[model samples]
Target: MASSLRLLLPLLLLLICSIHGGRGQPCSTSDIRVEQRTTGASVEGQPEYQVTVSNTCDCPQSKVMLLCYGLNSVTDVDPRAIKPVDAKLCAVAGGRPLSKGTPVKFKYAWKTPQDFPVVSSEIHC
Candidate 1:
């Protein structure tokens, strides 16, 4: 019994370490790139923007989260009116994984008062 216990102890430790090791390994920020474009005009008289997230890593990226916010007329945007733009790609459960060199694209529309003019937007992954 003592001999078997000793053998199992190392195996158990190895298994635990393997399981937890991956949790510490997150995808590198440098491996991803975010690109933005204005896809024509808004269909419903709103401002529309398209964002693409590309994975430049050699490994697959899973459950990636991207947040986007839009600002209209930098100086005049109403504080109460500020809100996150639509994240079309964010609707996927557990995030949509991308293979190396692949890209994911989404669109967002900002609702602003007439003549508010969107000046800039920000995205973070």
Candidate 2:
């Protein structure tokens, strides 16, 4: 009984480690493409836009992280206004899974006038 218990304990530990280790490693930056487009036009000093992330890899991706920053020489608009379309799915705890050729989108609105366009954005999985 003692020998069997010892063997089982190591196997259990290995199984647990493997399960946890396989998570949190999102796809590489090179495997994804991001694009931004204006939804319509600036409304009442605020601008609305949509950002899309496309998976270029052949496999499915999970736990994706997206960070977008705004750039404008005329005005200083808060970049944090850009948010995931689905807040719950894009939360830090876990992100939505994206399959190959599929894309995920986020919507953003600037509180102030955005004279410049979004020139910098990043993604990680």
Candidate 3:
């Protein structure tokens, strides 16, 4: 019994370590830029901005969701006025990932409610 217990103890510990080992080289893309556009202005209050989220990377890419916020404009409104947006993968060019550093994009339109302060927008992944 003592001999079997000793063997089992080391095996259990080794099993735990392997399970916790770090996973390497996740599918990663370069930092993206938010291309903002004002589609139709409001007669009053803050104007609506349409954000086009994009990924500009040189590899096969996939959409990654991130936290986004507005800055320097309104203090009383939500920092991340909009929900998390997903990064898009670039389409294939001749059966390959889009050109190196080309962007894959998605559009998100939102309006800053009256009295909400915001100057610039940002996203955190």
Candidate 4:
């Protein structure tokens, strides 16, 4: 019984330390830009430009996904129907996980169908 207790003590301590040390990290976005322009002589014109969203975290993320949504400033456009390639490109920058302070770039070419109300975007991982 004494020998068994000694071996189990170290294993228990390691298990407790690993469990306490494990955590989920948060990823943040920064430097969002939107440029709008008129397409010919139409009242509703989609903007054409690429907005880059970067991951600013120390931990690596899995299954990262990016998406765009319509704002209240534009009523003629619906974001649900807008695919990344139609004007924007929703793609995986790379297969490897993003490192600390490293940015995952996403190129988007979309028209808001109106003026841009918000100058920021978001991502999920």
Top TM-score prediction, candidate number:
2
Question: 123 in model 2: Cα distance from truth in Å?
Answer: 13
- Off by more than 4 A, model 1: 1-27, 69-94, 111-125
Ten contiguous residues minimizing lDDT sum, candidate 4: 77-86
Model 1 agreement with the true structure over 44-113: per-residue lDDT tens digits: 5766765556766445655554443333322333222133336322221234456566666555555542
Give each prediction's root-mean-square deviation over alpha carbons: 11.2, 10.7, 13.5, 10.2
Q: What ranges in model 4 sit over 4 Å off?
A: 1-46, 68-91, 113-125
* Candidate 3 to truth, TM: 0.31
How many clashing pairs per prediction, in order?
A: 0, 1, 5, 4
Higher-ranked by lDDT: 3 or 4:
4
- Which parts of model 3 have CA positions greater than 4 angstroms off? 1-30, 43-46, 69-125
lDDT of 4 by residue, 1-125 (tens): 99999999989877755543333223433322233333343223534433333444444543233443322222233232222322333222333444445554322334443332222233333
Q: What's the best-to-worst order under lDDT?
A: 2, 1, 4, 3
Count of backbone collisions in candidate 1: 0
Model 3 C-alpha lDDT per residue in residues 22-53, reported as the tens digit of each score: 22222243334446666575433556544444
- Report every candidate's CA lDDT: 0.48, 0.49, 0.37, 0.38
**Residue 13 error for model 1, in Å?**
28
TM-score per candidate, chains pooled: 0.44, 0.45, 0.31, 0.33
The candidate with the higher lDDT, 2 or 4, is: 2
- Global CA lDDT of candidate 4, please? 0.38
The candidate that wins on lDDT is 2
Residue 113 in candidate 1, Cα distance off native in Å? 14
- In angstroms, give how far residue 124 of model 3 lies from its true place: 20
